[model samples]
Target chain A: MSAKKLLVGIFDDDHTLIHAIEHIRHDGYKVGEVFTPFPVHGLEHALGLRPTKLHTAGFMFGATGTTFALSFITWVSTLSYPNNFGGKPFFSLPSWIPITFEMTVLFAAWGMTLSFYYLCKLYPGKQPKIVDPRTTDHLFSMTFDLDGKDEAYIEKLSSLLKAQGAIEVYIKEL
Target chain B: MSHFESPLREPLITGNKTWKKITDDIVVNTTGDIKPLWLIATLISAAVAAFGVFCIGWEVCYGIGTWGANKTVGWAWDITNFVWWIGIGHAGTLISAILLLFRQKWRTGVNRAAEAMTIFAVVCAGLFPVFHMGRVWDAFFIFPLPNTRGPLWQNFNSPLLWDVFAISTYFSVSLLFWYTGLVPDFGTIRDQAKPGSIRWKIYNVLSFGWVGEAKHWERWESLSLILAGLSTPLVLSVHTIVSFDFATSIVPGWHTTILPPYFVAGAIFSGFAMVLTLMLVARKVMNLEDYITIAHVESMNKILLLTGSMVGTAYLTELFVAWYSGSMYEQYAFANRALGPLAWSYWTMMFCNLIFPQFFWSKKLRRSIAFTFFTSIVVNIGMWFERFVIIVTSLYRDYLPSSWIDYRPTWVEVGIYVGTGGIFMTLFLLFSRFFPVVAIAEVKSILKISGDQARAEQWDEVKDDDVYKTLEK
Candidate 1:
């Protein structure tokens, strides 16, 4: 049940925190993950995080939303039993364009939001680990995923945290 | 803990009155004028709104002819003012929603009040159409009604119907978005308020049952994210649909395809301008320099520059499309807007929409509160003229020379527009007097972000203690 994992060291500035998420392809021990309370301008590349694909998800959700919207209106106006108004033909798609467009956008936003929620696992019944109570008020945190490392190595990681200007350090199991 | 490190700093606004003192003061202490300025302003606005209501009432009683709009100008002041106010609503949502999405921290101070402006502006907007039906009593005819006497379903085929859905959805959702953001801030007011008074009751009801719990923060953050996402496109769609009411038609100048994007752009442009106008006054009147920093105003001014340029681009696009489409009528309509008898309005529009915002690109002008304030008002005037030119110039110079008539808004139409101003300010005054002008929780979050650098230092010390006492094996 207890498996040794990567021992990653994190260091950061006061009034900020860092997770040393640096990889160790052939490591005895190394830094792994870091978090800062506020975005540190150059930190993304430091963490080796890939550029976010949120916009891509946004566009897909938007497109699917648009189709779902356009089609639904089309269905209702034409096939859902149409009442011909102002002598306009049944299934007048142009007339439906505004609503369809609105719907597409609505759905895209709704879908994207849900996807974001799902990704973050941000709904009920789950209590988020309070890395620090002041994280909500005034604190930053840095975390590292330990991988198959010795206890002494973890101590070394903790020492590295102190040396790197970390104001505080704590182990967190994710 | 260091004296400077105390998180329990006294709130900026506090009540000196105790439970009974507050009640007695509220009930009997009517002498001193702490808010007499707001009171006078509210009364004036209410008066104007009442007069405007009368004008609308007359328009309903007699018909659309009670106003200056005639058959040849089937769409006139009513339509123009409708678009103008809805355009005003855009600023609130834009200030709050889009800026929030971009993580523009400065938005927190002004967004709450700006959103109230949006809701009130939309209410003002919904009025014109409701009364413009010539038969105001039959206004509900626009809705999907089950009628006894020819109970007619809504015309789904009409772009106007789409407008109905768009505007109402926008109003309701914006209200929800605005209100949801206010709950915790209202709770702050409720907790901080003196007990057993109207202020207490008011804030308590408005806040619902918000607790400053972490779980609530999680839900709060997500819901805000979702609402912002919804509102971003809703902001675009509301005005786009409004434009569709004109673009989908075969009317000479109105049928242009460039409208939806142009309208949306113009909406945002005007909206930012209005936000600046209101915020400038609010900061001055309420002395909210700390809460609404100069940096926030500068950021808002910058947005005005960007969105105003977008609107300018739209104006140019309209001219280009008129020429490129090879339609002589469309070309003529464009020409009439500039060269016709009412050409001054067109030029004014160009100056306000295009030139005024350029001042903002200057770092000095953007930061100069005085200049930005004037420019904001100028931008609003330009947006109003933009509507007037669209509605008036094109219609006045229509195909039939016989129908060519110089149009002037009668007292009724002018009075009504002025009256809507009353309605807007009245509601806005009530809002400013009652609500907490900023989202406290959100502000706290931003402050945390600001102070993150300090806590980062303490974290190391904590880790050292953990390693020595707990981690030693």
Candidate 2:
């Protein structure tokens, strides 16, 4: 008689939680989300999430930084005013290395961090949903939606979650 | 199920003493918990550091000639001290960077102290260059200025300028990295502080809104990873450019392309050895054996061996290249290094850096706490000699046969060198006393993840909360 269907399961470990997304999907259940306090490798693929394109953007930003840093130094040295000290030629490439290398790395790191934060919509003051505070110190979790249709099916699912070794269970709604 | 055993050792002192109790005990000498000998030694160091600062002030006022520098040895003790301090600074980055890359969790225990070492080392280094320029007030000459001189610019071609850039960058990056890591630890201290305490206010001001939120934990990891990556390169470039100071020059002993890699290796080698030396003593004195284990001591020894071998190999390659170059000056430079005025130091260096690490190949020596501790000290001594050999041996034998004059470091030079040890230790003591010598958060994390299949099974958290509750409560 309930209008909402519910699904429940647990995992042997966080690694299992990460891998279980595929199994849950293969069983013909919609995986509305996967939640973990800390990162578990391969959770993205398990949940059918798209690959991040931040690294590629980082490379572009780094190259731009390198070029910008080198060109500015060139402008400072050769075009702006050239002075020869100790008989060495002006606009020396080897000399520009420390600054250029520094800028490239600085740009790549900052660029990548900013891109990830922006793309992920992460900002200061945003209160993230926490299933367990212990995740920061030591816990991991995987959660999926259980909404719409069948009471007997929900009981069977909750029992299956316990069988998978859940220490505790709750009928959480959000 | 069988219970998992903790591999951690007990701290030297563990009890329910409050901060007030601890401070009262320290001031009143009610508890002879720490050895008097160690306390006396620390005080002596503090005294010498005070004297050293006075001398540095005198040098700044009267110029670098206050010591034994002349035209032939234009860069004497000043540059030597610079190299020494910078080389020592490498340990912090090594603990934070290379060990982090390897996922060596042992690093969290010692990283705070090592990072403090880096900051102090940089401070000592900055002092030398400031005074080395005769007109200390005009030290801005090293920087590229718009109107200091007609089109005045720092020579990009000069290794000195490179050093200026490298050290400044290394210092700034290191400061940022250390401060970022310290923020949360400051929070822990803030919570433990008594109400209205100065420490509480300081910690509160410094924590920067670190509420220990789970999401901030995620961001912290990302930020640390990026800092580690950036710091790795920054640390490498710093010592490499230091090598460039000698490498790009045409001087017989100074000029060699191998210098960069060799210097970086030696810097890390010496740095680790110094860290071990200080840590062993501190662990015993502070009663922190559990926090800093024998495993950590062994890991550092292994690194010492690897870097020592690398340095030895560099030494051999230098000798070979000198022979193969068919240049008589290069030949004499190598020959004089072993049999010259400071041949004793050269051999002492060889013995410490070359022969001692071979003992580490034996697990018995490496694992023996006493042996490893002594070996660490000896390796530090050897690394110092290696620097002395590289600086004095080459310069003592100049191109002009008549100009080949023997030089000896003055008592002032020796005093200042030893005094830096004082400054280093004093700062380290202050750091340990004031701050969390161990990264409490990271250690807590590592310990939590290490065991507990139940938590691993049910909670997606890497750690076991039951264990934390037991330990902390």
Chain A alone, TM-score for each of the models?
0.70, 0.74
What lDDT would candidate 1 get against the real structure? 0.69
Error of 2 at B129 (Å): 2.7
DockQ of 1: 0.08
**Residue by residue across B207-317, what tens digits does model 2's lDDT show?**
553445323445556667766877788789889989988988888988989999999999998888878878888777666665677667777889989999999999999
lDDT, model 1, position A99 = 67
Worst 10 residues of 1 chain B by lDDT: B1-10
TM-score of chain B of each: 0.87, 0.86
> How good is the docking of model 2, as DockQ?
0.09
Where model 1 places Cα greater than 4 Å from the true spot, the runs are A1-89, A100-174, B1-34, B149-151, B195-198, B451-473
**Could you tell me the lDDT of residue B413 within candidate 2?**
66
CAPRI-style docking class of model 1 based on DockQ: incorrect
